[model samples]
Target: MADDQSLITILEDSREIRDLLTETLQHEGFDTLSFARATEFERNMRGLKPDVCIIDLGLPDRDGLSVVNTVASNSGAAVLIISGRSNTQDKIVGLELGADDYITKPFEIAEVVARVKALLRRKAPKAEATLSKIVRFNGWTADLEQHLLTSDDGKVERLSFAEGQVLRVFLSKPNRLITRDQILDDLSNGESDNFDRTIDVRISRLRAKLHDDPNNPKVIKTIYGAGYIFIAQVG
Candidate 1:
């Protein structure tokens, strides 16, 4: 209803839950559109792209995951899946398919609000945030918004969602040792499994993309028993 506010679209079949979410988001200064069916959401979303889309997996018309995949690919709106499915595999599938965050149902309203704000923080681009959009170091450029890295020689490398998240964390705390636990915690919303080895693999992949030598990497240095540090000047 509020045109000037950040638009948030909520898709839930339950009237009570839908109303509650719409009311909560409106109270939080977000303009919201509520849809009781996936088809309604799909059709309306074509004309009005919201800043965020809160999707419930139990839609009556269509599979919510399909909707999530579609929205993730077609819309710039951040997707947050709210489903009763708490299985790790389900969450992982949602994330891998491009959902930004996933939360189980019967969740605390406060937590929902918190996660919503967090997603908005990640999506909303400010001047200070723009500094993070393009990070250059060691002849490689990381574009957070575009999710691509460009080398000085004009070679472009596309980054996965998880990779982009990792790069963002590193850019935010440049020159500081970021522990594996910290990375897991920072990326907990996206990562379904909280395993240390997962972070190690991701870091290894990122280093490879940066062309850092595995034997003696300089850009992302492993701190023995502590963590990894982004040893580059991020401007």
Candidate 2:
């Protein structure tokens, strides 16, 4: 959200937990900031306003749930409950209290990273929060207002920033062949030097979100070094 990497605030008093989280997050290409306690976090998080907050439920001086509530209640960051609590009740309560994701103790770093990525995906404004309101393609549904996506009866999956951008472009120009060069120019705002694979990677990722088989694509058809065509019945 800030520049290219999303800003993440990790609030945990334990040095081990803090180190593990920072390692996992930095490996996933995130810009991270850490705090020792609620007081320290309150000042930094409010001022920085990261897109995501990975918070431990066992702070030294404050209730972790209260921190989650405060962050969610006051700031824009999506709060994730990362704690030693393993009971189902703890998880349920965390979710009820506005936690986007809750992980138990002894969790794998990869799992934490995955959950963070998913939360980040759900935070994308283009796919989840504004403009156009909705995009209807084939049997898939994208609701910007609610930040939800439903593929027929399947569970709702969140869209990342790049996926949202690629889909938004197609939704804006339905049934039309969009030139690769045009897409590159638009995605990079013509400021990219030479060429980059970012657009291609994003398109692939978008197709995955739509559940479109790259081998026998239904929604987006690649034009073989040219561009792409959105063949769905858009509305």
Which one is best on lDDT? 1
The backbone clash count of each candidate, in order, is: 0, 0
Q: What's the lDDT for candidate 1? A: 0.79
Model 1 ranges with Cα > 4 A deviation = 1-4, 37-49, 70-77, 121-132, 137-141, 145-163, 172-177, 184-226, 229-235
Summarize candidate 1's per-residue lDDT along 81-166 as a digit string, tens digits.
Answer: 89999998888777766677788988999888787787776554534544657788778888877678899999987665556777
What are the Cα lDDT values of the candidates? 0.79, 0.71
Give lDDT tens digits, candidate 2, residues 1-235. Answer: 2234688889999998898888778877888999879989887664685878898998998999988866654554667778899887787666555565677788898888777776666455434333466877788888644435688888776654335555666776778899987765544444322224346655776787778898999889998877899887876
Model 2 lDDT at residue 217 = 93
> Which pairs of residues clash in candidate 2, taking residues 3 or more apart in a chain or in different chains?
none
Total residue pair clashes for candidate 2: 0
